[model samples]
Target: MDFWEADELAAHRATARAWAEANIEPHWAEEQHRTGCHQTMELHARLARDGILAAGWPAEYGGSDVDPAFAQAIFDECAERDLHVDGWTTTSMVLHTIAHTGTEAQKHEYIPAALRGEILIALGYSEPDSGSDAAAAKTTAVRDGDTWVINGQKMFTSTAQVCSHIFVLTRTNPDVPKHKGLSLFLVPTSAPGYDLQPIHTLGGQVTNATFFTDVRVPGSALIGEPDGGWNVMRVALIYERGVSSPSRIEKTLAEDLASWAREARRPDGTTVLDDPLVAERIGRIAVDEEVGRLLGRWTNWQAAKGGIPGVEGSMRKLFFTEAEQRHFSDALDILGAEGLLAPEAPGAPAGGAFEHGFRAAVVTTVYGGTSEILRDIIAQRHLGLPRNRPGG
Candidate 1:
C-alpha cells in the first residue's frame, strides 16, 4: 500500500544532505540567477566523484556504478537543496549512446572525459520550426571527403552557452521518408561557424537558439548507424524523462508545494493547513505525486534490468507535467493575492514560489513532448489503438 526505501538508502540520502550543506547550497541558486545557467564544473566533478552524477549507469561506463535506488537517493538530496547544473541530468544520455554504438576511438574520446566533467553536451534535437514533430527536422549534414559539414539551427537548447558540445540531429538523406533520413552527430562547440544567442524563458532561466554554418566534424562524430538517429532520440528521451532521474524532480516539487501551504496563512490569519479545502487540495497533490513516483519506480526498475519499460515514460511524463501545472495554479488560488506577488517581494508567500512555479509550469507542458503527443503515444503504442482515425 505504500513505498519506503531500505535503511541504507535512507542513510545515503542523509549523506547527500550533508554534501549539499557543505558544497552546493551557498553558490548554486545565485549562480543560476546570475548567468541564466547553473554550470559549476567544480560542483559537477564533486557530484560525479560522490557517485551522484552517474545516476543508474554501470561502473565500466563511468557511472557511480551503483544500483538505481542508490543513485536516485542521491538525486533526491540535490533536489531538496534546490541544487542544479544545466546539462548534468542529460550528459549521460549522450555518454550511453557513445558507449553502446560508437567506435572504440569515439568511446574513448567522449565517455571518460564526460564522466570526469571535462566535457558536456546539450541535446540539439528541437529546431526553430519543430516542437513536437521532431521527425521533420530540416538541418542537413553533408559529407566533404573525411569531414561532415553541418548546417542547421536549433532552438530550446538549454545549456548551449555553457556546454562543450551538442549531440545534433541532422538530415543526411532528403530523398527518404522524413524520419528515416535523419542522423545524429557529436559536434564540438569549439568548431568554427557555431553561434549561439540567448532565449530567455518564463522560468527565469536562459535556453538558446543555436546556429551551425559549415560546422565541420570528422566522420567519427557520427553516433550509431547513419539514418538511425531516430532510435538514438528514442533512447535519449527515456533518460531525459524521469526513468533515470537522479532526484525525482517532479515529486520533490510537489512535496515542496504541500510543505509551503502548511505554513501559508489566509487573510483571516488562519494557516492554510487549518482550512478543509486547502487540505483536500494538498491531499490530492500528495496522491498524484505518489502515483508519479510509483510509475517512475516501476519503469526505473526495468531500466536497471536493461530495458525501457512499456510506455511508462509517457505515462509518468504526462501525469507529472499536467499535475505540476495544476499544483501551482491551485496553490495560487489557495494563497489568494499574496500568491501573485513576485519572488522575493516583501509580502510574497513562501518566497513567491507560486508565481515562479506558475510561470515554470507553462513550459513543462510543452517540453520533452507535449501532453497531446504523449496522449497519442499512449493511445497508439501502449493501448494498441489505431494511429489514424477516419473523421473521429
Candidate 2:
C-alpha cells in the first residue's frame, strides 16, 4: 500500500504537533498527578473546541471535512509523546456509531454536543463472563413504557468514572439467539442505580467495574433497533479494530533504549550496544516496530479507499499489540535491574516508563480483541478456514 505523505498531510501533521506541544503537554504533569493516567476531559474539551478532535468529520459536525488521516496525524503525535487519548478515541467511536444508527432526535441531543466535547461516553460491553464473546453479554435492558430499566454489571469499562454517559450493550430479547437479542443504550451516569468501582491495572491505567441496578433511561436512549445491538456493535468494533491512528510506542522505546545503550559502559570498557545479545534484541525490536508501522498504514490506506478492514484489521491489531509486549520485555532485559525501578525512582532507565509499559503491554493482547481471537478471524476470513467459534 502506498502511504506516501502528501504536502497537505505533512503540513497538517506539523500543525497538529505544534498544537499538541502548546496545549496538551502543559497539562501532562498535573493530569498525571491528579488521575494517575486517567484523563479528566480537560484536554479532550480543548481538542474539540479547537477543532482538532474531529477534523475529518463533516463541517456540520464541527470538523474541517478533511481526510481522516489529518485527524490521525494529531492522534499519532499525541501517542508519540506518551499522551493519553483513550477517552477521546472511545468517545469518538460511540459518537460515530450514534451518528450512523441514532434517530434525528438522538442525533440532535447528543451528536453536536459530543462533537464539541461537551460530554464523554464510555463503552460497556464486556462482563464478568463475556470477555471476548461480546454477544454473550448478559446485561439486560427491559422496556418499561416510556423508559428502559437496565440492570447488570460491566467489566473493563475503561473510562466509566470520568464519562458522562456509557454506550451499553444490553440483552433486550433473551428468547432469541444471543446475538439477535442484544440492544444498545446510552445510560447517563447521574441516574440512580448506576455505580462504578475504579480498577487500577498493573499498567498504570484506571478502568472500572460498572454496576447497574435498576437504572432507568428514556426510550430515546436506544441506539438502532430494539434488538439490533450486534449490528451497532459491529460498527463500533470496526473503529476499535481498525488502524485509525499510528502508534510509535515501540519505536520510541527502541530509540530510548538505544540512547541508553550507547552510553552504558561495562566493566570491560565496552558499551551495552557492543554486546552481541543486546544489539540483537534491539535489532529485533526495531524490525518489529517497522513491520507493525507498515501493517497499520496499510489498513489505514484500505479505510481511505472506503473499504472496511476485516482480516486486515485483525492482523494489524494482533501483530502490533503482540509486538508491543515483546518490545517492552526486551527493553527490560536490556536495562537489566534498572528496568525494575518505578517512575521517578533513582537511576531508572527511561524514567521507569518502560517498566510501567511492560506491565501495561500485558493487557494490550486482551483488549479490543485477544490475540487468539484475531488469529481466528485471520484464519477464517483470510485463509478460508472452517468456523471455529459457535456463531462464526
Candidate 3:
C-alpha cells in the first residue's frame, strides 16, 4: 500500500497541527517538563477536549475512529510544539490493548473513562528478574472460590501512583510452560493489598515498583481466559512497541541542533558548523530520523490494514530508539559543556534539553523492548536466522 496519506488524513494532520499550535505551544516548555501525575492527567484532559486523545476508539465511547492516522498525527503535532506526552504513550498502549481484547462490559466501563483522561492502566509485566523476558514473570495468582489472590512485585510500572487500575500479568498455572501459564488481570490500584513506590529515573519520569500482597480480585477482573494471558499480553506488547504515537519532538530536536551550529562559536572564534565532523554528525542524525520516520509510517500502515505488526514492530522500535540515543548523544557532543546545563541553567544551549534528552535516551533502548532482544526477534522472524534461546 502507498505510504502517502489521502486528502482526508492530510486534513487530520492539519487539524492536529492547528490544535497544537493554538493550545499547546504557549506552554510548550512547561508541558514538556511537567513530571507530576496531576500535571499529566490535566494534559490528557486538554488533549481529550481538543479531541486528540484516544482518537482510535469508537465515537460512542467519547473517541473518534475516523482515521487510523489520527493518533500518530497528534504525536507528530505535539512533538513539533515540544510538548511532552511521555506518560500518554503507555496509557495509549494500554487503551489499545483493551480495545482489542476487553469484554463488552470492560470496554463500556474503562474505554470512555480513558478517553476523558479519567483512569490510567499501569502495565505490570516485567519483574526485577524478568525485564525483557516478560514471560518469566513470577508474580503468582491463585484462584480461591470466586477471587484470585496475587503476590509479587512489578518493576518499571509507570503512572501506577496515579492509575486507578494496574493491568497485571500473573502466573496462574505453574505446571504449564511459562508462557502458557500466564494470566492477565485488571487489578484496582486501590485494591486492599496493593502498594506502589515511585522509582525516579534519569529520564526525569517516575516509573513505579508495585507490590502485590495477597491482592484479591473477582474473576470478572481477569482480562482473558485463565492461563491464556500469553496471547493477551502479546497483544499489549505489540501496542507498546508497534503503536507509533509520534513524539516528533526529536524531529525538530535534530533540526534545531543543525540550525544552532551556524551561530555556535568554537573556542577559537570559528563557527561550530565549520568542523567537518560536526557537520557529518548532524547529517547522520537527519538521515536516521528520516529512516525511523518512514519505518514508523510503514508499520502504522500495516496496523491500519488489520494485521498485527510483528517483525515490522521490532524493526521500528529497534531503529527509532537506537536513533534517538544517537541523536541525543550527537547533539550533546556537538554542544560540549553548554549541553550539560539544566533547563533552568543560564546560557544553556537548547535550554540544556539535549543534555536531558541524552540521559533519557539511555532508557529508551530498554523500553517497549530492548535493542538486543528486538534484534534477536528481527533476526529470527525477518532474517530467518536460527533462534538462540538464552539459558536454554
Instruction: Name the candidate that leads on TM-score.
Output: 2
Assess candidate 3 and give its TM-score to the true structure: 0.90
The whole-model C-alpha lDDT of candidate 2 against the native structure comes to 0.81
Clashes of each: 3, 0, 1
Which residue pairs collide, candidate 3?
A: 75-246
TM-score of 2: 0.92
| Position 192, candidate 3: lDDT | 93
Better of 1 and 3 by lDDT: 3
lDDT by residue (tens digit), candidate 2, 344-378: 68888776788888988999899899999989888
lDDT of 1 by residue, 1-392 (tens): 13575443665666556766776757676676656684667778786676666555555656666555565666666666555665876677677666656887888778877877778998899998987888888889998999899998999887878899999999999998887888999989999999999999988778999999999999999997888888877777766664645555344545666687677666799887788888888888878878877777667667666776547888888888898888888888877777899876897866676798799789877888889988887999888998765532
lDDT of 1: 0.76
lDDT of 2 at 265: 89
lDDT (Cα, tens digit) per residue for candidate 3, span 167-193: 899999999878899999989888999
Clashing pairs in 1: 75-246, 75-247, 76-247
lDDT of 2 at 346: 88
